[model samples]
Target: MSDRALIPLLSAIALTAIIAACLVGSTTMSPGRLLAAMVGAGGAGDAIVLWEIRLPRAIAAFVVGAALGLCGAALQGLLRNPLAEPGVLGVSACASLGATLALFYGAAALSPIAVPVAAISGALAATALLAFAAIHTSSVITLILIGFGLSSFAGALMALLLNLAPNPFTLSDLISWTLGSVANRSFDDILLAAPFMIVGLVFIVLSRRALSALSLGEEAAHGLGVDLPRARGFVILGTGLVTGAAVSIAGAIGFIGIMAPHLVRPLVGYDPARTLAPSAILGGVILVLADIGVRLIPSPAELRLGVVAALIGAPAFVWIAIGRGRTHG
Candidate 1:
């Protein structure tokens, strides 16, 4: 199918997955019950389950996945590197690290919003750093390396926190933040993320034309009057916002960003600009399905969504890395 057809089809699939998410929880709502709940006519229990629990979780999962996917597509386009992703910028790690600190310090006991607030702050800090670098530095490699340093430092700090954990419970909580989840989310969480997500999305949208131009080659793009530095700033800032927002909501869900664009690019004939929406849709579907699988697992403690994502995404990441390396070499 063409890009137009493919996008709508992916969107339909995403919708189906989200609906499945709403209907396949522990209570297993029937279509009729789901409809009634949508219209606010279901039983009180059903409404609570669907509206407060399932629907919020499903939407949060979609929003997180879409953010990562859009960031991945735009990053890959900007860098002209297939291996690029939001995590490549270290914003996701920094965000998670912030949340880990909150969990470590017991801020979560004070308020549910504390962890998310910390995570988003961390991500914005990364964005500010990257934005400054984009303005001052001419090389993309410098930005990537700086991100690597940030990620490495953040990972080390997280490890230290894990090691210095005062108790098993604290350790487990810290680890869980890394493992990631959207369980027990509510509309309040979504509302909190909306503004940041919108800002991030706008940055990416504004960078799309520059991304398309850069795909031809930096010199050719410059000839076409693409403001490379400005584009880089927008892409980096956008990526930081969405990535932080995603990690805040879902606690460092991994690989969807890289996986989404890679899977969709072939279908879209590898047009960076055309890849964003389809990648986002596929990313949402992937996460929803992963969460569904998490629900279906027979394990006693319920599989963490990040665990499932890593299980699926890590292999794909390696495979894609290999493919890109060989093609480029």
Candidate 2:
């Protein structure tokens, strides 16, 4: 489909997904009741359930997914690699490490703001290191290897924190955060992360033209008047802000970034520039649906959102890897 047509289709799908998500929680409500609750015409209990519980959770899921999707598309374009993702590149790991440290020391108890700040710090550190490496070497293979090393190191640190947990409750909280979820999130959490997400998204949008030029290779892009350094700066900063803020709020949800863009690329004629918005919308849809699915599945307890995403994403990752290997081979 053309960009114009594809955009409306994606928007409609996103709207449908959001509405479905709002309706399908542990305490299910009909569409009429949901609308009534939204507009303050429903009972007090229903209002609290819909407004305070489901609405915030659904919105958080969408925001987190949109951030990841946009970052993934931008990173794929910037790195010119299909496998590029926040998790694959260790950015999410680094942010998780930061959040883990805060939780480990009980900073979260002291202040809700501490975790996100620390996460952002870790993300910026990782992105800066990656930017430095990119300047010194242009090999995608090298970058991927470096990312793997960083992820491994961060994982080790997380393990250490877990081993030294002061109590079972702290340990459990740490585990849950690492696993990721949007349940029980409040509007305050959304308010905290929105500014960073907005800034990151704006940076990505501003660099769309440059990202398109980048698909043609560095030298060719330079010849086409693309300022490689500035473009890279925007992408790195944008990715750091979005990914870090997302990790802070939702823990380390993975694969939506990689999956969303890949799903939408063909619809947008494979144009990197056109892929960003669609990927974001689809990402929101995917996460909202996943959140709803977790609620509906029969279990002793609801599944972690991150775990569900990983279960679905890991197979997709392997399939993509195999296909790419075949294409290259």
Candidate 3:
């Protein structure tokens, strides 16, 4: 389908996903009951489930997916590499590390907010560092390498923290946060992350035209009046904020950001700017569906959302990589 047509379709699908998410869970509620609850005529229990639990979780899933997808689309466009994701910048790793620290130090035991706050702080710190580096060099390859190195370092640190974990409980908490999930995510989680996500999205959107120019090559983009360094700063900071806030609550969800854009790119003819919104919509839908899948699974213990994403995404990544190799060859 044409992008103009596909965009609306994606939006509608996203809406459907949100609706489905609200309705599908371990405990079933018929559509009639849900609708009655929505109109305030159902039992109080239905209202609590619909309004307090399902709706907030669905909305949170939608927004988190969209933000991460936006970052992935922007990054791929800027890097001119189809495989790039927010993780490429090490923001997710840093956020994970931050949460690990909170778990390690027992800060999370004191309050529910500690882990998310630390994760956001870690992500923003990485963004600032990357932004400063961007000022020194305008080479995209250098930036990617730097991000890779940072990610590796953060991963190592996280491993060290895990090794030194004081007890099994701390170890479990660390593992859980690193694995990622959207279950039990309340409205407060959405509210806490929304501001940062919005600002991050605005930054990416601001860089959209530059991203399009960049597809023509850096020199061409520069000649076309794109301030390459500032644009890089915008993407790094924007992606960092979005990814960081997401990791705070969801705990390092993966693949949705990458898969979302790739799924929508063809419909938009691979134009980076044109791909963003639809990609975001698809990302949200994909995550909500994934969350719903975890809920409906008959396993004694539910799978983490990130685990499901990796199972689905890693092979797809390789497939895309191999396909791109053949296409270029």
Candidate 4:
């Protein structure tokens, strides 16, 4: 098969292996027993560990990773910014701050839906404000400046909430969650995030054709019959919602949005339509593997997935920056 075709197949196999490894590594069970538990043949202890614990984290990693990937692609395509990312642009921070507030004020503690709902609202609000700032600015640099401003504001608010939390445990939990982890995610968390992700996915998928048009530049896209304003709105809405759900569950896992899409874009021969799906798959694979790697590398104490990704991505970013400098120079 060609390189384009090989990627999806490889990604699928890699994801399966990582998932299997996670299941096996989470406890002392052999692969055979893990498979048995997965297939409902094992006993209650197997069921509890495999299903109740490992399964949820695995699924969360996949779903949240997919959302992050899709959002990254959409935001990059919409803004035509290689560095545009939900977390980096600060939308995820806004969502986290909103969720933190809800939890701190006992709104989410009192109602099951409050955290995600509040988070989605906050994400949408931030996007809207950013959009408004972008509209008046007349330049991409201005847009980036506005995005940075919004992100900074949201981050500051999150810090304030951390200071005001009622107890040290609450503060620690919120802080750690903001640092991002898929450990001990529940069915409720899945349900809460699913709708936003699904809806966002639909909009993102719909924008594939528009994204292709967009790659040629907005004026050219409009000249070619793409509805620029409508497409922009759709992309913004999709990114915001997907980002919100991801933050609500996984906290602010940065760079996956920018890193995943950019890495995969060249593999698809720069076809934006093909880029989105493959990026999503690779994104899921990346996060799952990162989570599993963190678990395996340190053994008992469990390293954070975000830290692992950052370590890898930080070097990758440096390499990319150096390459770009050489190319331009």
Top model number, TM-score: 2
- Kindly list the per-residue Cα lDDT of model 3 for residues 1-329, writing each as its tens digit: 88778988888898888888888886888889989999999999999999999998888888878877887788788777777776667777888899789878879889877877788778878777766765577665577688788789988898788788888887877788778788788898888777778888888889988988988988899999999888888877777777877887788777777888898888888899998889888888888888888788878788988888778877877787788889976
Tens-digit lDDT string for candidate 4 (1-329): 35567576857765685567456564567777788888999898988888888778877887777788878788777776666677767787888888888888889778888888878877888777766665465466677667677778887888888888889988987886577888888878988889988897888888889988878887788999998778877777887788888888877777777678888887777767767887777777778877778777855667777777777766765576567568756
Per-residue lDDT, model 4, residue 176, is 66
Report the poorest 10 consecutive residues by lDDT, candidate 3: 132-141
Off by over 4 Å in 3: 106-117, 125-149
Query: Which sections of candidate 4 miss by over 4 Å?
Result: 1-7, 136-139, 299-301, 325-329
**Which one wins by lDDT: 1 or 3?**
1
RMSD in angstroms between candidate 2 and the native structure over all alpha carbons: 1.4
Candidate 2 structure quality by residue, lDDT tens digits, 45-129: 9899988898899989988988888888999999887778888788888998998898888788898788888887788788878
> Candidate 2: lDDT of 119?
85
Query: Clashes in model 4: which pairs?
Result: none
- Superposition error at 157 for model 3 (Å): 2.1
Using lDDT as the measure, the top candidate is 2
TM-score for predicted model 1 compared with the true structure = 0.90
lDDT of 4 at 150: 75
For candidate 4, the per-residue lDDT at 137 reads 59
lDDT over C-alpha atoms for residue 157 of model 4: 83
